[model samples]
Target: MTSSLMRKGSRPLRLPLLIAALAFSGAAAHAEDEPGSLPRSFPVATPAVAALPAAPTLGADIAGLLEQARASNPGFAAQRAETAAARERTDSAGALPDPNFQVELMDFTNQMRGGGTTLVPGRVGETRYRVIQALPGWGKRDLQTRSAAAKAEQAAAGLDAAWLDLALTIKQAWLRYYAADREAALARESLALLGGLEEATLARYRQGLVPQQAVLRAQREITTQRIAQVGIGQRRRGAAAALNGILARSPDAPLAAPAEPAALPSALDLPALIARARAANPAITADERGIDAARLERERTFADRYPDYSVGVTNNRARGENQTWDVMFEVMIPLQQSARRAREREATQMLAAADARREATASRLAGELGSAWSTFTSAQETRRLIRGTLLPQAQATRDASRAAFETGRVDFDAVLEAERQLVDTRTSLLQAEIEARTALFEIEKLVGETP
Candidate 1:
């Protein structure tokens, strides 16, 4: 009876598994018959992509925009102010400490006047005036001065780095604006082409040469293009707003269309770029200055182990006709050995940390330069291929299909498909152009331009 029950359970499990397998097979068969199934080869013939008119030449140039940002951006202005303050600090870093003055009344009450207090110094029993100047340990002042100067240099480098960041942002915004504007222009041109196709399809339908579906398809494509145009326009406005904000203007402020981006060089010298960045990149320079400052500070802390000195001169005046002069000297005792040692260790560790940071900064900058160079080269090649090969081929196919459709040799779908391919090819070219230019801007920000 147990064996009979186990066999019955196994039969039930097999029936479920068999049903699942059949269901999967039917789903796969249906997927293969689906109209949107991927084809092994792309369709080559399609309608013509209308050529866009030239953009108006009135626009803001990138150089002008960068200058405007540098002058107007509040963050950059704060950095400039900090740099100036650092410079001011350098002038007073090594100045001597303020002198001390004291006046002593040896006897404020006069015995001759029955113990009455005297207010005037000339009538007092004795009066003393002293002036004292304190001097730091040997070489401490020089070290402090050098350290402060190094810090000032670091601040200046930081200012330069901030400017570079602002410039890169402006360039990126300019490129985005250009790309969106071009896309919008392309969409408008495509819409006109679709309208012409719709009219032709309507005429063919009236003569019963084509079905109403063909005209409907044209109208749908026009609607789609119009939707895309609206999106592109929004992107364009957003880019403009970003630029305006960076320039310290109202976000809704209107901006002239962006000019065409500068062309990238045919070849880049990656090793040379890395070398330049190591020497000139402001962040790396700032780190190097920090190491110098830390070294000076460590030396100054070591000097703290020695004693400081104070010298004073005293003049004594009496009620009688006698005057005397006195000279005094004082020394600071460095009795806090534990505290001094701890401070020395702290300074030494800070020096090491600054050195490590400089090394890390250099390595990171090199890595970034290499990455940007790779992207720039890749985008350049892609742009070349699209413009030289893909664009012309797409245009030829579109023209051929459009001609065939007019002769009634090809269906309207072929023309529509070719137009899409042409538009896609154009978009790809624009993306490659923007990518290459953006990479070039990154490189410039990293390595700095030649003087």
Candidate 2:
């Protein structure tokens, strides 16, 4: 009778315990069905550490990048070094050849006769001292000096061009990094939103308020977003690697997310931009210097055909009574030498080549200016449109869909669609920003100054 009473008392507790165990089991099963469950052997990606330290936090501005390039970029440094070396050569032109000095003994008595030496003018054992100097061709040194100076100037301009190109490249890489970060963030947010929708839909289905099809659709979206996230993440990683490469770091080094580019200032008139480019652009200046150098070289080469004068003093002692000293000036007139003809021909060819190159460079820069100008204008318009209209519309649509879904008027599919639209719009805006930044870099590169 006591055992029967205990059994009746335990029935309520036993039923509740059984119900709780069943609920826990169902929750576990649902979690197992969820995507992104840690795999039995989920492979964690090891951090890439084979590369070097982070790039020095030189400001991300163009000027900072340019300065770094001048210091560390081998090509630019080589050009600057060349300029320095060329300028040093100009000192060679004005340098006079070493003056020669001579000393000799003169005898007034016949040494063969064993005569006594006399210390007097035109006497035996008299010592004579003299010096001599060589005169270079008239204006030859001046022309050579000018030519060397021009060459040095040309090299300096080339270095400037190198710096400008490097600055633009860094800016482009920075913009690319920003784009990658933006896209990756969007992908991550979409993935999280899809996962949340999957959980909500699963709950609704369990309550019998929504069909199993809704749960399946949410799962599909989660899978799709996960795939997109992976893809964007890979792209972001690649972009980071590229940024490291630009900073002269190993390509695998981890990089901090780059900042967005600053807003572009109001556009400059094309005419003004072109004028500034012509005056200050390194490529154009280099060509101009090259033309001047070529002219100087031509003049110097022509001067090479002229005669050079050498003045010297000579003393003769005959081992006898007779001795003499004479001062002489000699002119080495180079007759119609084959070398002169060759040099003239060479100079003519070089002058023609320089002229042609200058023209080509100018034409190329002009075309580039035009293209960059057009791109800047177009990107500005696109950026304005995105900021003013498209982004707002996408945001509004997404907000409306969220409200509808909360009120149970719209389905989970509508929410996913709205979310996808919002992500796309954001990505497009990022692209527009990148385009504008790239255009600005191009303008600065061509103009050699900020626009």
Q: Write the per-residue lDDT of candidate 1 for residues 135-226, one digit (tens) a residue.
A: 99999899989999999999999999988888898889888888999898888888888888888888888999889899889999999999
Candidate 2 per-residue lDDT, tens place, 1-451, comes to 4564356546434657778999998788767654755543566565687877667555344455546555676665676788789889888866778998876556656374467765554445555666789899999888978988898889888878877777777777667666777787887877777777778777778878678988888888778877877877787777666656665667776554555556687576888877888888988888889989999999988898899898988665544346578888989979878989899899989989998997887777778888988887887888788879988998898889877876788987787788888888888877876777787788888888732
Best by TM-score: 1
Per-model TM-score, in order, reads 0.82, 0.73
- Can you list the residue pairs that collide in candidate 1? 46-418, 47-415
User: What would you estimate as the lDDT of candidate 1?
Assistant: 0.88
Candidate 2 runs further than 4 Å off: 1-64, 97-134, 250-255, 315-328, 337-342
Error of 2 at 218 (Å): 3.2
